[model samples]
Target: MFIRIVKMSFHEEKIPLFLDNFHSVKNDIRNFPGNNFLELYQDKNNPSIFFTYSVWNEESDLETYRNSDLFKSVWAYTKAFFNDKPQAWSVDKLESLP
Candidate 1:
């Protein structure tokens, strides 16, 4: 599996709006085809900064999602609140332990 991590920094005043929107569509994203996991994290020292962590069966799956209407609409809404350009990375899982 591959992991996708996205770091986003939003305007302080827009955080609540972003959170509400995320809550509304998170399930749909998590259940999207080829997606195995989804999570959100916030920076303790920087309230405006957040990260999205997700796992996908393949890179193509992520690409497909990126091109979907769901992603387009969600990203358009989310992008408007950004304080800075978002950053993302895709990497392979080297190991995991239960």
Candidate 2:
């Protein structure tokens, strides 16, 4: 399995728009073929910053999603709300401590 994390810094003024776009994002991924799980997080100290935690069957599944039209549309809208470039990382799921 692959774990993907994305950290985004949103513009204060664009929070509403970003929230609307996130609905679409969530719906899209929820129905995707290889998505395993997803979670959204926010920093208590920084409301404008958010993180997405998602698991996929493989890196190729993520790549396919990223290259899909839905991602393009979502990303184009999403990019406008960022205070800084979004950062992302992918890793192999090695062990679960629990």
Candidate 3:
């Protein structure tokens, strides 16, 4: 599986709106075909900075999601609140330790 990580920074006042939207659609994203996991993380030093960590069965699965209506809608809403351009990366797992 490949891991997808996205870092986003929102306008301070818009964080609540972004979070509410996330909560409303997170389940749909997590259950999407070929998705294995989904999680969200906030930076300790900056409340407006957040990260989305997800796992996909393959890169094509990620591409499919990106082209879906769900992604388009969510991205449209989320991007409106951005303080900066979002950054994303897809990487292979090196190791995992319990």
Candidate 4:
């Protein structure tokens, strides 16, 4: 499995816009080809900071999604609210506790 995590920092005043945008597009992302999971998280101390966690069947699947129009539109809307450049990591699972 391919695990992808992205950290985003949004402008405080634009947080609501970000949330609305996410709410509208999240389902499309979760249903995208080769997507297995999707999740969102927020920082305890910094409400403006958020993270997206997702799993895909493979790296190529992720690349295909990233190049899709759904991603293009979603990213265009999302990036407008960013307060800082996003950070991301793609990783492979080595083990599971259970």
Candidate 5:
């Protein structure tokens, strides 16, 4: 599995507007191919910050989504709200005990 933790900070006064755009992006990505799961969380330390926790079937799955129209549309609107370049990374488990 692949995971991405995306962090975004919106302009404080524009948060409600950002949330509206976020809802749209959330719906678009949810229906994309190879998307296993997705979640959004707010930073306790910083209410202006948001995090996107997502799981993908594979790296290619994410790439496919990234290259799709959904991503393009979502990213275009999302970029306008970014306080900085959002952070994202593909990650995997090194080891797990259960």
Candidate 6:
């Protein structure tokens, strides 16, 4: 499995708009094919900064999602609220320590 992390910096005033949009589509994202999990996180120091942490079965799965209409729709609206360019990473698990 692999992990996809996206760090987004939103316009402070647009945070609520982002949240509302997320609320409406998060479920569809979580249920997307090849998605293992989905999570949203906010920076304690900066409410305008948020992260999306998700796990996918493989990199190709992530690519597939990125190419889908769902992503196009969600991202189109989501990016309009960004204060800065979003950063993202796709990584494989090296190890897990319990």
lDDT of every model, 2 decimals: 0.97, 0.88, 0.97, 0.96, 0.84, 0.95
The Cα error of candidate 3 at residue 85, in Å, is: 0.8
TM-score, per-candidate, Cα-based: 0.98, 0.92, 0.99, 0.96, 0.88, 0.95
Per-residue CA lDDT of candidate 2, range 72-94, in tens? 88888889889998999887767
Q: Tens digits of per-residue lDDT for model 1 on 1-98?
A: 87999999999999999999999999999999999999999999999999999999999999999999999999999999999999999988888899
TM-score of predicted structure 2: 0.92
Give the per-residue Cα lDDT of candidate 4 at 95.
91
User: How does residue 24 of candidate 5 score in lDDT?
Assistant: 65
Among these predictions, the greatest TM-score belongs to 3
State how far residue 68 of model 6 sits from its true place (Å). 0.6
Better of 2 and 5 by lDDT: 2
RMSD to the hidden true structure, all candidates = 0.6, 1.2, 0.4, 0.8, 1.8, 0.9
In model 6, how large is the Cα lDDT of residue 40? 100
Rate residue 66 of model 4 by lDDT. Answer: 93
Find the 10 residues in a row with the least total lDDT in model 1: 87-96
Per-residue lDDT tens digits for candidate 5, residues 61-95, read 99999898888877887788777778887789688
Tell me model 3's lDDT, rounded to 2 decimals: 0.97
* Ranking of predictions according to TM-score: 3, 1, 4, 6, 2, 5
Q: Is candidate 1 or candidate 2 better by lDDT?
A: 1
lDDT of 3 by residue, 7-77 (tens): 99999999999999999999999999989999999999999999999999999999999999999999999
Error of 5 at 56 (Å): 0.5
